[model samples]
Each structure stands twice: as structure tokens, then as C-alpha cells.
Target: MQRSDLLYGLIDLFESFWQMAVPLSAQGEPTDDAGPDPTQETRQLLTYLSGGLTDGAIARELGVSERTVARRITRLQEVLGARTRFQLGIQATRHGWI
Candidate 1:
């Protein structure tokens, strides 16, 4: 595999292990999405993701757990019908989400 792809896989593997080590009941910081505007956390996550940061790195930057970063990514993927992070970044840029 390409080095980039291998690094991505390794990041995901480490994130999975981190999540498993943490409590399943641990909750992420609450976000306010009541308005039409995107929450700051969401925007930050997108920015980090667009910059090609791994979930762990993004989580550290956002002061949240990797699981929380993964959850936000899943939500964004569903909202944008994006099958991958690259697609999500493209769609976000198209819609000016980031």
C-alpha cells in the first residue's frame, strides 16, 4: 500500500484502540446546533479534517475524544452523502461549510 494510505490506516487503528480503552458511556461536550448556523465545534472539525488531520489529531486540537471526532464525521458524511473524507471536504467546500 502507499505510505499515505498505510498511515491513514494506522491512525484509524490507533483511534479504535483508544476508543476501546475509554468508557463507552463517556459523553462528548454538548454542542449547540439549534440555529441554522453550524456550531463552532463542527466548523473546527471540518477545518481540521479538510487539512488532512487524523481523528486523533483533530480530537486533540478540539479538546475532545477521538470517538467524538468520529461521531461528528459520521454525521457530516450522512448529511452530505459523502462516502469518504475527501468527498466530504469537496462537498463542504461546494456548499461553503468550511
Candidate 2:
């Protein structure tokens, strides 16, 4: 019963979000034009993301707070006009930024 309940709940949640999901082609593009070139520090930070490091790991390597790592990632998302880290990596690669 619990397994079925969890399955049904997930299906319902998927259905709700599916109604609002954008189509695939639109999903590939960035949310906006690539803004100004990111600073060198920003590029370095994103490089760590490319290497599959978590925010805490990045903070440890960079000697900053985890919150600072997160903030830089958020800013990178905005600058690259990406909605997610995966998208950010794609956009940055496309723009030859990283």
C-alpha cells in the first residue's frame, strides 16, 4: 500500500508539472542573451563545477564559505542565462567561456 501510494503521488506530481513544462527545443536555449563576459574568478569557480565538485568541496578548495560558492554559481547562472547548472555548463561551453 505504501509503495502504491508513493507511486501514485509521484505520478500526480509529474502530471501537475507536465502541464506547465516547456517543450524540448525551447529548453535547449538559454533564458537570455549571454550577458557581459564573466570575471576570471567566475570562470575558475565554474570550472570546478565542470569537474563535478559539490559546493562545499568548491568552498574548501577556494577557501570561501559554501554560501559564497552558491552565490557565485547563482551569478554564473544569471550571466550565462541558464536555468540550471547543466544548462549553465552547456551555455558556457557554447559561448566558449569555459
Candidate 3:
């Protein structure tokens, strides 16, 4: 399969696992405190990164500079206590954040 197709499949699998692992409330919100509203951007960045997007691509998609993306990712890592992108992805998966 193509890379995009593979990515989509992985995303679908992750979504399914997430739904099974952490059901949403009747109001359609996650039960846990993933973080504050200001961290929404960090969550988006993590999602994009998990989907295999590069910092340059994420910067373009988010309409921000690559430097800003890097900085935000660093801050996200700090907040999540993730030592690496792989760890961030794992933490996100475990916390049902994606």
C-alpha cells in the first residue's frame, strides 16, 4: 500500500483502539484532563507528528514557522514529560489523547 494509505490505516486503528480504551461521555468529551485549552495546539502538533508529518510540513499546515513548531513541540515534550517523539506518541496513545 501507499504511504498515505498506510498512514490512514494506522490512524483508523488508533482511533478504534482509543474508542475502545476510553469511551467518550454523553456530551462527546474525553473524560480525562488531557490538558488545558491552551494546550490544544500541542495536541494538534502531536497528532500531526504521530501521523508522520515533518516539522516543515506541520509548520505550513498550521500556518506557523518551523522554529515555532519546534519550540511548541519542545514545550509539549516538557509538559508531557516525554523524552522523545516516540515517547510522546506512546504517552499520547496510552492517555487516549490522539
Candidate 4:
């Protein structure tokens, strides 16, 4: 398998273990959408973006409008504290959301 795939898988395993081991109250962090990860749709969007797909292409592939795609990206940025697409991608990967 590719290095990126292995890294992503390992990150997911570690995150799953971390969640199982820690309680939310013990972590002392405010929760949103149930955890520190994006929703499945948001993860799919990030995957398309990381694969270098444009907004229009993603829209077509997902049967959504360009506007919808843009809005989702914007929402993800706000939720993830990202100011730009590059930052969003980085943050999503760091969160194991992509």
C-alpha cells in the first residue's frame, strides 16, 4: 500500500483508540457535531479537494450544485478554524477527517 494510505489508516486507528480511552468531560473540550471530526459528507468533500478536484467537478460528481459545494467548504472552514482551502485541507488531514 501507499505511504499516505498507511499513515491515514494509522491515524484513524490511533484516533479510534483515543476516543475509546478518553471521556469528553475529562478532555474538558466543548463538543460540536458529537466530536472533533467533520461529518461524512465533509470528509468526502475534503477527499475530493485533496485529490485536486475543482468545486464544479465535485458538484457534478456528487450531484450537488456549485453553490452547495462552496457553502459546504465554507462551513467546514469555519468549523475547523481554517481561513483558506489549503488550511482547510491541512486541518482536515490533521484531524483524520479526510
Model 2, 44-85: lDDT tens digits are: 887999999999999999899999999888987777656789
lDDT of 1 at 43: 89
Q: In terms of TM-score, how similar is model 1 to the real structure? A: 0.61
Best by lDDT: 2
Q: Which stretches in model 1 have alpha-carbon errors above 4 Å? A: 1-35
Candidate 1 C-alpha lDDT tens digits along 1-98: 44798889999999987663412122432222223556778888899987889999999999999999999899887776566788677666655578
Using all chains and alpha carbons, the TM-scores for the candidates as numbered come to 0.61, 0.63, 0.58, 0.62
TM-score-better candidate, 2 vs 4 = 2
Candidate 2 has an lDDT of 0.78
Each candidate's number of clashing pairs is 0, 0, 0, 0
lDDT of 4 at 89: 74
Runs of candidate 4 exceeding 4 Å displacement:
1-36
Among residues 3 or more apart in sequence or in different chains, the pairs in candidate 1 whose N, CA or C atoms overlap within 3 Å are none
Index of the highest-TM-score prediction: 2
RMSD list, candidates in order: 14.8, 5.9, 11.9, 12.9
Across residues 35-97, which tens digit of lDDT does each residue of candidate 4 receive?
Answer: 555667777888999999999999998899999999999988787666778867766665668
**Candidate 3 lDDT over residue span 20-76, tens digit each:** 453335444444565765457767888899999999999999999999999988876
- For model 3, the local distance difference test gives 0.74
Worst 10 residues of 3 by lDDT: 22-31
Candidate 3 ranges with C-alpha deviation above 4 Å: 1-39
Which model, 1 or 4, shows the larger lDDT?
Answer: 4
